[model samples]
Target: MADLELLDKSIRRVPDFPKPGILFYDITSVFVNPEAFKYCIDKMVEIYKDSEIEAIAGVDSRGFLFAAPLAEKLGIPMVLIRKKGKLPGDTYSCKYALEYGTAEVEVHKADVEKGKKYLVVDDLIATGGTLVAARNLIEQGGGKVTDFFGVIGLPELNYEKVLAPSKITTLINYSGK
Candidate 1:
């Protein structure tokens, strides 16, 4: 694994972003640093290399950054879990709650094949709503969510409880912003 201390420093903390009194841990800084970006994916691969994952289900946008390369490295299929109406064909949708309101996510009905195992990837985990919803969409489409992986985790929110019974792995954790 890469030096987590140095990787943690690469992440930028921005306060009051998109709202008042909310400290946002911006991952864009990590994306710019090749070493940090590779470290994040390397650690994730190291952790799951032997898990026999058949596909990687990446939550929209930021999740694609890490998941795409990781899926390439692992030689597995990459499944996209997108927002409502973003997918073209038949899709399975799940509604999840955000801090302020609820949002919906969708996955193509054909992408999640039966008997395949998937790992859900995201940039970060706060309330765990998105990951939970992603897992639901995957299962509802006939694939199993083997695990949930994130580059960063905010344990202060106690997302572990919300994602109970399924394992969640993260490269770094911050108690608060």
Candidate 2:
């Protein structure tokens, strides 16, 4: 198979998922492929290795899955941006509108350090609302977001609207129907 075809085959796509028109691109298939999963992380590391990121902040839920291994490999701390009230101690939060409604994400105040560079990780980027909220919280805590990385991206969603002043990296990009 061609390289692109091979890579796409390993990702499972669920149609009309989470809503009537959403197509969820799932990466569980990659978890079963050691080489593919390793390639995924290696690519991310290569891109951000020289970015001098002191911390990797992962958005709640799926973001944790990617940040854990990446942080271990890079030997940096990993902070969780969780759902409101999920974090212990002093926290900062940002609320945004989701596809259906509104939601809030939080991060501990102590997890971020002044003048430190950070990378935000999430499963995918649709409209970029969630990641933007996470980035705002990081910057509010004195951390700078060097880049936003994800496994998949919905190019049609116009991430630039939310990430206007920043850029993002993704292993795969899709313009779903």
Best by lDDT: 1
Error of 2 at 97 (Å): 0.6
Residue 147 lDDT, candidate 2, scale 0-100: 83
lDDT, each prediction: 0.91, 0.85
Task: Give the alpha carbon lDDT tens digit for every residue of 112-172 in model 2.
Answer: 8879888899988889999999998999899899788988888798996788666688888
Kindly list the per-residue Cα lDDT of model 1 for residues 1-177, writing each as its tens digit: 447977888999889997989999999899898889988988988988888799999999899999999999899999999999998999999998888899999999988989898899999999999999999998898888878999999998999998877788999999854
| Number of the top-ranking candidate, with TM-score as the measure | 1
* 10 residues in a row with least lDDT, candidate 1: 1-10
Q: Would you estimate the TM-scores of all the predictions?
A: 0.96, 0.92
